[model samples]
Target chain A: MSEDKNDSFLSRLKAAERRSGLKTEDDTKESADDKDGQSLATLALRAGTEMISALIVGVCIGWGLDKWLHTRAIFLIIFALLGGGAGVLNVWRLVKPPPV
Target chain B: MAGGSSIDVLGQFELHSVFGGLGDALHFSQSPVYMMLAVVLVLAFLYFGMRPAAVVPGRFQAAAEVCYEFIRNMAIDTIGPEGASFFPFIFTLFFFILAGNYLGLLPFSYTFTSHIAVTFALAMMVFVLTVVVSLKVQGIRFFAHFMPAGASLALAPLLIPIEILSFLSRPVSLSIRLFANMVAGHVMFEIFASFVIMLAGFGVVGDVFAIGPIAINVALVALELLVGVLQAYVFAILTCIYLREAVAH
Candidate 1:
């Protein structure tokens, strides 16, 4: 009779946990760890692409402006330098920790 | 696939008119067709999954709810309460790319995301939306962001252009990342698949060696599955982040 009561109590607790959609502390931590690993990979990928894309955008704009103005590589040179700076800035923004 | 003795790896990306004359006349390509198919598939999945909305929730209903809640939580958490207003857009973007990525993994299917044109279009849309939202939310103050706070006025000329370039690079980076990742994965698949085919030509010993490439291809498929979902998640979360900045005081 005591064993039967214990089983019923355990079942009731399980049912309440399910109803509340609560996870054990371990479950939440494990999932968070997994997500952190994935996001790290994503951050690495974003850094390289972000840098290159910024440079590309800068070069393209510079080339277009030079062509329109007949500046003979002046705009291109200026833009390329600016674009390179922007690329570095982009990478910096990506890797820097968020402000508190 | 191996065309004669040479591997035509890039042949898979070529666009061709489907449905014979009708498609040709309409200038309809496989990219848009697959996009439509992806849309239809997502809608049908949601419709059927939710139609039997039992109180207890069946397996299909559970899966649909999980998807909904996942995007809902992502948006709300990333963008605050204003995210609810943008939930539909993020959900649609996430699922659309997710569907496109997974669908492309199937044999004889085109991965539209592999195209820079398609990804750029999507990225531009997100970029424009964020800009518009910022302009609306912050008024003329939106231009102030081009000049970083505490920056000296003497360096504004050089810094302003660099800032603008970095800002413009958002869509470029967004599009290129997705496009490049998809293209690289598919190209690797094609190369490995061709290796298996090429190796099979030398009879029994060749067939035995072909297993090496086949194994790699199998592993690649698993990796691609992860890549597909991860890329979708990254895209959606980045959108949320951008929107958060846009709406912030």
Candidate 2:
């Protein structure tokens, strides 16, 4: 009885695997490669958006602070530059290869 | 048709209260109704799909298992060993956004995710979670992350603010990306669909031209399907990435 159940389970696993259309080792590798390519695209997309958003956030913060402090453009200019730098830093960290 | 019959593309986004008196009192609209529907659909899919849970596994069980494994692998692959703890959160986020996107594609349904308010709220939740996790896991050391390991002290004045700004922007970027993608896709779909209707009003010759917009609309549907999945994947993976950073030594 135990042997029969084990056999049935094995057969079902194989059937399900086959039905999923990922039959061969080569197909699995191809899919992995495709995922890697997609990951790269995802990284690129994240990098650009991250940079711009950071810059915008910085400018907003700076402008708000300047307005409250009644300190004209000083905070705005400083924060905008800082924001740009931060944006670059974000992109750098995002795209940099993981440390071995 | 008169020249005044221009495509009211943006008008589709307008909100109106639903459910009669209750809707009016609560100021609720179809957006919330569709949101609830999306939630119910997702719950039903998971519950029905996994109901059998057979050793041999039927089709619905298999689909449920596949979804589970896909998200499990994603969390583990992106977040390392600690990924298991956050699996449920990531899975829920992915499926919720995905269900919302697909539900909106149905006629007369609203896409809540397309709204900046909804997406921003979701993004802020993830952002707050990341911050809380980082603080809990790393204590005061979380602040150290703002300064690059090798940066000079002389540049501290400039570097610190910039790093802080970038750190602050994660939620904004995440929210905008999802919201913009959903809005753009739905607007294009509405435009092309309206074009088909407009052209068809002109009779035979116009009906022939309508086929062009129809074909484009079909292709756009296929593209939107791919995009819905892609955006969900991106959102989930990014969450994992942020969580990974939070928990990292």
Residue range A3-78, candidate 1, lDDT tens digits? 9999999999988886787766677899999999978887888889988998899899989999999998998889
TM-score of every candidate: 0.90, 0.85
Backbone clash pairs for candidate 2 read: none
What lDDT does the true structure give each of the candidates?
0.94, 0.88
Off by over 4 Å in 1: A1-40
DockQ (CA atoms), all models: 0.75, 0.67
Task: Flag clash pairs in model 1.
Answer: none
Q: Which stretches of candidate 2 lie over 4 Å from their true place?
A: A1-45, A97-100, B1-5, B201-203
Model 1's CAPRI class is medium
| Candidate 1, B41-134: lDDT as tens digits | 9999999999998998999999999999999999999999999999999999999999999999999899999999999999999999999999
